[model samples]
Each structure stands twice: as C-alpha cells, then as structure tokens.
Target chain A: MSDLKIIKLVKNFVGMDRPAVNNVNLKINSGELVAFLGPSGCGKTTILKMITGLFAPDNGDIVLDNKSLLPIPTEKRGVVMVFQNYLLFPYMNVNENVGFALKMKGIDKNVIEKKVREMLDLVKLPDIGFRRPKQLSGGQQQRVALARALIASPRLLLLDEPLSNLDAHLRDEMRDLIVTIQKELNVTTIFVTHDQEEAVLLADKIALIFDGELQNYTSPKNYYEQPKNIKAAKFFGGVNFIKSKKINNEFISDIGKINYVGENINDLNDEINITVRPENIKLSKTNDFDHNSFKGNIKSIIFSGTHTRYKIIINNLELECSLQSLGIKNINQGDEIFVHLPKDKIWGMND
Target chain B: MGGERLKIILSLTPPLLIIITLFFGGIFYGFLQSLGYQPAIGKYDINFSAYYNVMFSERYSKLFWTGLGLNLWVSFASTFLAAVFALFGALAIRKTFFAKTVCNFIYSLNLPMPHLVVAVGMIFVFSQSGLLARFASQLGLINSPGDFPVLVRDKYGFGIILAYIWKEAAFFFIILMSVLQSLGENFEELAQSLGANRWQRFRYVILPLVMPNLFSASIIVFAFSFGAYEVPALLGVIYPQMLPVMAFEFFLNPDLNARSEGMALSIIIALIVMILVVFYFWLTQAKIRKD
Candidate 1:
C-alpha cells in the first residue's frame, strides 16, 4: 500500500489559452480509493495521467510513499493505468497480455504461467487464457485489463473511466468487481470519472474539480450534501436555490418563511442563497402547515420509473421536487400540492 | 435485384477482361515460347529443350545459375535492409509534428523517381571516378580517383543492391507510417504503465501490431526487385549478371532460336516470385487461424 500526494500540479497544453490542469493539490491515504470527479474537459483524466507519469506536469510534485515520482519513468514507478477503452494489446491472447509485465521483468516461465492463471481467476476468468481480446465481450475485456494491471502489483493503480464504455448492467458488475478486488488487495487506487454516481459508489473520498482547479475533496456523503459553491452543488444532482432575505432572524423567500435552524446569524448580509436538493423537498397532496411549506401548482411531471420529478411554481418561484414512485397515485400537470423544504436540510451560502 | 447484379458484373467485366487479355495473355505467350514452340522461328514441335539448356546444358548452365544466385542475393538483401531502415525511420519521426513533416518529405522524395533514373544516380555517386571519388581526391583522402573503392558494377552487386534499397525503402516507409498513425500511442502508453520499458514496449506491442503490414510491404519490394531489369542492367557486374539482365542479353542475340531461351528465363523468374507470394499468403493465413 502507498499514499499519494499532489502538490500544486499544473499543465498548459500548447496552442491553448488556458492550462488544461491548474494548481491542483490532493492527498490520498494509504490503501484509500479516491475518485477524481468532474464533467468532461475538467482535467480529471489529465491528473490521472500526470500521476501515472504518462504526462509531465509543468509545475508541482507528485510524491508517492513520501518520495517524489517526477524523476521516475512510468514503468519503473510501479504505476499502472487502465484506460477508458481498456486498450488491451490486440496481438496477444489473454494469458500473454496478463503475463507481459512478468515476462518483461524476466520472471521464470513457469512462475509467469502460474501467476497469470491466478490473476485470471481473480478477475473471474479462469478459462479465458487462450482467447484474444477481440473475442471477449466488453466486460470480459475490462476484466482482462484489470487482471493485467493487478498482476504487476503496481504501487498505485489509476483507472480512467473504466466503466463508461460498458452497458448499464455490465457497469454495475464491473464496478463491484473493481471495488471488491481493490479492497481485497488493499492497493492505493485513484479513478477518474465524469459520472457522479460511480464516483460516490466506488470511492472512499470524492475530489471534485472544475475548470482545472480543485473544488472540494471530502467524503462522498459530505461532498454531495455540502458542496463548496453553486457549481459544485449543481454537479452532484438537482438543486433548488431560494433567493431569500434575512428579516428578524427569519428567512423570507418566494415560497414561504422559516426561522433559521442553525447557529448565530448575526452578520450584516441581507440577501443570501439557500440551496436544498430536489429529493430533500417533500411533496404531499395536502398541506399540514409544516415549517417552510408552500402550496404550488405542478408545472410539469417527469415520470422516470424509479422516481417522479415535479417542477412546481410557488409565488413565481420554480422549485424542483422528487418523490418515490412506490404506492404513489397518478400526479398530473397543473395540480395543486404542498412542497415542504426542510429547514435542517437546507444550506445557506453568502457571497 | 437481377438488374443490380447485372450492373455490378458489367462494371467489373471490363477491368477483368483487360487483366485476362494483357496479363495472362502475355504469360501464355511466354510459356509457349519457353516450351520451344516458337512459330516465329517456324519450330512447331513443343519440347523442354530450352529449359534444359538454361538449367543444365554445358554451354549456358554456368551463366544461368550464376545469374539466379545474383538475383536472389540482391532482392533478399535489399528487401531486408530497406524494411529495417524504413521501420526505424518511421518510428523515429512519428512523434512530433515538425519532425514528422520534414522527415516524411525527405523519405518519400525518391518515390516518384523512375527506377532507371535511380540506377543512373547510383552510377554517378558510386562509380570509382564519380562524385565521391573526385571529392575524396580533392580532400586528400585518396591519391587519385583510382584509389576509390569500386561500388558500381562491382563483383558483389553492391551498387545494384544500394539502388534498390534507395528506391524500395520509401515504399516500405509510406506503408509503415500509415500503419503507425492508425495504431496511435494508446497501446504503448498502456504497456509502459504495465512496467514495460521502451524496447520492451516496442517488441511486445508496436512490432507485433505492425508486422502484418511490414510483411506485405516486403513481399512487394522483394518481387519487384527480383524481376526488375533496368537497375541491375545499369549497375551489375559483367561476371555474374542479374537474371533479367542475362535474359535481355539472350534476347539481343542474332539467332532467332535465342528468343525461346530468353522466354524460358523470364518464366523462371516469374515462377519464383509467384511461389514466394503464395508462401507469404499461406503464412499470414495460418497466423490468423492460430489467433
């Protein structure tokens, strides 16, 4: 197991006005699985490549196990990257591909064969040694890539959107496989992904980045619930922002009025932004006069099988709400309903 | 559906008919003459006399056998050298944009040049009294032009091999560059991440991916060099000439009967090239089946 630290990393591509990656710093604990999460062109994969030594950083240092990795070549650094496409060597069969690193190290032929078999079995592919990569399904090829990366026992394993190419069903299976194998081996791992759910599901911590800068690095739960700013909040899922003014320690917005739930609000800011997740807002057919409750007409109803989403307008303020589909009656457009925005679930940001 | 099928066949028939009329037609005429059935000389009776004379008759056997050896030597050597050089050249220049452009332009500069012009170019540069010899004497590296080594028309056919390498290396370079461009650097990056060094990645990843194209390109170079006439004719030594040059000499003979021997030598060269091409095809197919 090894810990990795990135210090003020930056990369400026030629002919580009801005750096692809700019002044980012992160520290991952030993045996910790971290996910660099962001949207496309956010430099998440660029950070992974820099860590794996595929690309050089223009500034800053990457230290693995308290030693600087900038001076080491990729092969000697014991860092392996499983690409998004699972770029398996098409010329070699499964056994050869997995055993390639061992062969390069001049391991004994019998030892390589035995180790390769063990790796294949670990990836749940016991009898696929003779098959070429093209002959395998997408999931099988992903497993082969994982087996090959793990067989070398790399100090740090980097995965660049390894499941984005997989279909929905296979994505879950591969995700479980990767998480299980990563925990079983206890190797330090970092995976880059544009998917929020995958990052939340697989990573011990999620590091959110945007526009080549680190936004927040924290536990997945905290990172989702307590984002640093409006952009980070919107990236995780749907968020409803209530423009409110603080009056006599009570917040008043277009929806309704609610007393402050948290500690001392003795500051001088009159206007502020209060963010609540769509799922946090409860919807009901009848109003019980609850805290922060308002009556609204459904502007639109989106039926997404698992959950039903409603765009509701209350006093000219549009608020999105999602409710579980279980045992729910038919809800249509333009129906009057009450939206309860829990005070405890709402977060206030002053800028 | 019938009309579509007829239209496809009609579109294909003109080229197919021309191929049959020109290519196979010429081969058939050559074979007829090789079998000693030359109606031009009014020798109607067909026999293997010309082949026998070319292969074993006391008078011409030595020249025919020596020419065959020289043909094989120049073709195989030049093909191997040119392919190795081109592979390295393409690999070296593929990374950077400026280097790729400049190197590619220089590498392919000789591609459109005629084979005969290249052969004469080799003569101007490599002959003892040529440019290099004069430059060497003027630089005081040698006493006179006579002190320069004989590279053109030498006994070892060095000059002919050099000319073929200069011309054919460009063909191999173009094929290899296209292959390398399509392959990209993803596999190499993956291999490096898997703990493979530069040489290891090349051997295990890049070489195997490029081998099929390389082999196919080599077959073309080998076949062309083996049967090509002008280069060897201009640069070959007198004692052991290349087969095409020897056959051309046989055709230049005053006797009408000499045409059959020339046709027989030409047929022999064609048969050798056909056998090589078939062998390469079989080898590549077998590899595919194994995979």
Candidate 2:
C-alpha cells in the first residue's frame, strides 16, 4: 500500500550550471524492489535524498500512497534510508541502535526489547546485540543497519549503495539477505547503485539515469534488449554502433544493409544509430544468416577466462564480438569469419 | 624493531627530560616546602603542620573553606555553561556555509585573548560606575552610577565566572566545530530518518557523538579555572576569594613561614583537581559500562 510516485522532480545545486536532478519522473508499485541505477554523480542519490526529505526539491511532487509528502518533514515522512556507510550510532550497542526507532515512538521498554530481539534474529545476529557498532565487521554493521531500518516498519526503505562497501562474497550474501527481507516485509524499496550487475540481478525494475535525467526505466531484460537511446545502450555494454540511415524498411550502414525485426521500424527518423550487443552478434565459420550476414577477417582474439573476445574488420568497419569460450573452438587471429547481425537483436536509436 | 624503538625513545627524550626535570622537579620542590622543609630559613623538616594550618587552624581555616567553596562553584558553573553554549553554537552554525565561515572567524577571535584582558573588559562593561553603569544612568534606568548593581569584585564571583565563560566558550566552540565538521550530518540525518524529531536527534545522536570531546574539553577548562589566578585576582572580592587569589595573598605576606601554607594550599588545589578528574572519568566509564 506504499506506492511512490515522483513527478517532474528538479533540484538545482548552487554554483552548478545545470540541475543536479532535472525533471525526473518515476512510478514505483507497492512491494516492488526498484533500483535507481546510474553512474556516480548522476543524481540517483539526490532523488533518494529528496524522497527521504533530506533535500527539498525545487520543483516536484513526491506522492506516497496518493498523498503528497512534500509538506511532511523527514521524521514524519515514514521513509527510512540506510546510508552508504551504515551510520550506526557509535555510542549505542546493537540492541539500543536497533530499538531506537521504537524508543523514539515512546513504546514500552519490554516491547522494544522483544522487538529488538526479533530483529536481531531476523538479521541472523542474535548473540551480538551487546556489542557496539565499532565492534562489528562491515557486513555485520550493514546487517545491523538493515535491522534498525526495518524495525521502524517504514513505508519506504531506501538503501544508498548498500553493497558498495562489501567484498564480493559479502556482497552476494547481503544481496540475498536484502532480497529476502524486502520480500518478507513486502515494503516498497528503492536502492541506489552504480553496479549494473547488482541492479540487473536485484531490481524488479531499473530506473537508469544519466546527466541528471532519466535515460530509461524498464524491466532489466528490456533495458538490455531494447534500450531507449544510444547512451542507455552504451551503458549496458553495447559497444558496436553503426551510424545508419533508415530508408524503405532497411538500414544502410558502413557494415552492410542491417535488417531488424520489430514494429515501427519504418516510423523511425531518417538518420539513426544502429547498435547490437557484442555478445548478441553471432560469429560462425559459414554464412548462416541470409540477409544480415557478412564475411569479415578477425583482426584480434582475446581469450578471457569465461568468454573469448574478437575484433573483426568488415568493409573497413571494426566490430567487437564476444562468444563463450566453450563455444569458440577453432577461431584464431587473422582468420576469415562470418558475423551475423540477428534481425531481432539490432536496435535503432535516434539519439 | 630494536633500532626503531631506540629511535623513537631518542626522539622523545628531549621533551621528556624537559617535563621531568622542570615540571615534576618544580612540583617536588613545592611538595617538600608544603611539608615544612625550608632550606632558605635553615629549617629542614618534613611535617604536616602547613596542611593542618590551612585546613583546620582558626585564623586561616574560615577564609580557606569559603575560598574553596567559591573556587569550586565558579569553576564548575563556568565550565559547564561555557561547554553547553559552545555546543549549541557549533550545532547551530555547522550547517550553513557562509554562517559557519563568519561565525568561525568571530568565535576564534576570542580564543587568543588573555584572561586578564577579558576580566578588565568585563569590569568596564558590567561594573558599577563603569561604562554600563554610566550608560544606564544616562538612559534613566537608574538614579546614578552607584545605583547599578555590583558585578565586578562582587562576593558571588559573577564577574570572574563571566570572564571565564567568555574566554573558555571560544575554546570549547573551536573543538566542537572541528568534531561536528568531521562528523557531518550523517548521524543526525540517520536519526531523523528513524522518526526522531529535532530534540531527539540532538539528545541522542548529536550529544553522544560529541560527548567525549566535550568531556575532555570541560576537564581542561575546569582544571584551568580552578587553578588560574589572573581573572579572579583582578575581578574577585576580598571576603570570599578564589583559592589561587588567597594562596597568592599568603605568598605576599612578610613572614617566610606563610610560604609553607601557600605551597600547601597550591598542592591542595592541584590534588582536588586531580581527584575530581578521576571521579569524572569514573562516572563516565561506569556509564559506558552500563551502556
């Protein structure tokens, strides 16, 4: 019941030429875990702060449960944010820190104690309640922070780079814990992260931002398969871009006539940029596709641990292609190969 | 490791030797004199008569007890008020960039001022027949300059406490500002997000986070105000004076035997400060253990 909507959000910082967050709009359903995915300084954290009422937006309306939250102060907004460093109160032990919200609400001591124990069990750290935050490891502190935030039963839980401070193993562990708790409570959550893999793996929907603007907001699969713009495609690791002109349902580029299978292909602008993921480009010994296949000489081959990367030159156009190492059997540098651009994979963008 | 340890000890030797010989040597000499050893008067003996005379003798005990009371009252009140004022001031200005810059400049201006100068300034501003008294008389608030209440050289040590608060608040403010700047607004923001209002945020997050620094600074302020002679001597009253002023009066006496009592009183002041500091640490440590 805690659906959140951000409409025409704009915030301008002093001394900056452009806004830090400009006219960003988003709708998040209740119980859905949304990720505000962007690079550093792209205003993802700003939007989170505005929602938490730490920063007031210059022009916007943030509505929670169909009620405007713009006039509410931060403490009354029913939104809690776990900071990047997990700012646990250094003076308090784990029990006091976790029970602080209830204590603030003037709840009874025994109730708070019981709830604190329950939260400790939920976070899987029942015996460490007497230790100070300084005594905990980084991952343990993160869990304590999560416990504290959840103990409040907030309407919206915002996490700012929750896994950025953890090692790879702890990151995976905390990711699972977060997903588990987020579902168990069914709280609407939005976490800001720059890591694309974390966003893709954890988010029900990813809101990609760039230069203080919403680049694209969609499901993870669509964000990768059908990026809305060239920047979104580039951010998702789409490296091979060909400047093409759309004429009569065919895209003419330096590589060849690119054919894409999608509705509204003819409705695109006259000039557009065509891009496909490197992994999506099929490289084979024989010309498998009839319309969108080309023979190219492999200029270089790099054998990574999981995949093999190849740089192929086709008609003065160098295209990067990656294939599974197990699938790449007889490919070597300086070999003639046939690269096929799948009709359903080629994406056309006007920007 | 041996060479590194030797280098560290060698580097520390100069300051250590200076402190041991000059500082501790002075205290040792003073302690001996307080125990009734006077080489200048050809009297070398160790006894407790000086301490007894200062604490129990009929002639000086009354003055000693009252002076001790005044000293304690002034030190504790001034130190606590100054720390509290500086903490609120720091918190108020920590969020604004321009205000913080301007307030920092203004606050630091008082830190370099001497206590004697501040005491004199206090007298001029607050004493009867001074600038404030004359101004009040002119403004028709009072009949004459004498109608203004006595502040400086008053029996209550208001003028002395005022001077100490004015000077020490700046010191506490500087320490608090550095701590608050380093802490930033993260803890307060976290508390706010947890549904704590303004007072709760200050009470829980801000107070505890700054407590250690404030406690240490308060200890230094308390110890200094208890022992310092300049401001109280300039602005204190005669009947019930601070310990340092009364001690200096004993040193000014012509009888050389009075120096023993003065040394004993000085030692008593130092011992009281040390005991109070230990007690403060014990109280805070007990609280920490409970937490």
Give the top-scoring candidate (lDDT): 2
RMSD of each: 2.7, 2.3
Q: How accurate locally, in lDDT, is each candidate?
A: 0.89, 0.93
Q: Write the per-residue lDDT of candidate 2 for residues B66-134, one digit (tens) a residue.
A: 999999999999999999999998988888889899988987898888899999999989999689999
Return model 2's CA RMSD, one decimal: 2.3
Q: Residue B78's C-alpha lDDT in candidate 2?
A: 96
Worst 10 residues of 2 chain B by lDDT: B282-291
Model 2 DockQ, alpha carbons vs. true complex: 0.73
Candidate 2 clash pair list: none
For model 1, how does the per-residue alpha-carbon lDDT over B1-291 read when each residue is reduced to its tens digit?
999999999999999999999999998988998898888778998898999999899988999899899899999999999999999989998998998898789867889999999999988988998999999999999999999999999978999999989999989998999999999999999999888899998888889999999999999999999999999989988789888998888889899798889999999999999999999999999988987
User: How much lDDT does candidate 2 score?
Assistant: 0.93
Tell me the tens digit of each residue's lDDT in model 1 across A1-351.
498999999998998788889999999998999999998998999999898888999999999989999999999999999999998888889999999889989999999999999999999999999998889999999999999999999899999998999999999999999999999999999999999999999999999998899988999887556666677778888468878899887888776786557432565268877778888888878887558888899999888999988899999989898888888766789998888878777776564
Cα misplacement distance, residue A342 of candidate 2 (Å): 1.4
The DockQ figures for the candidates are 0.79, 0.73
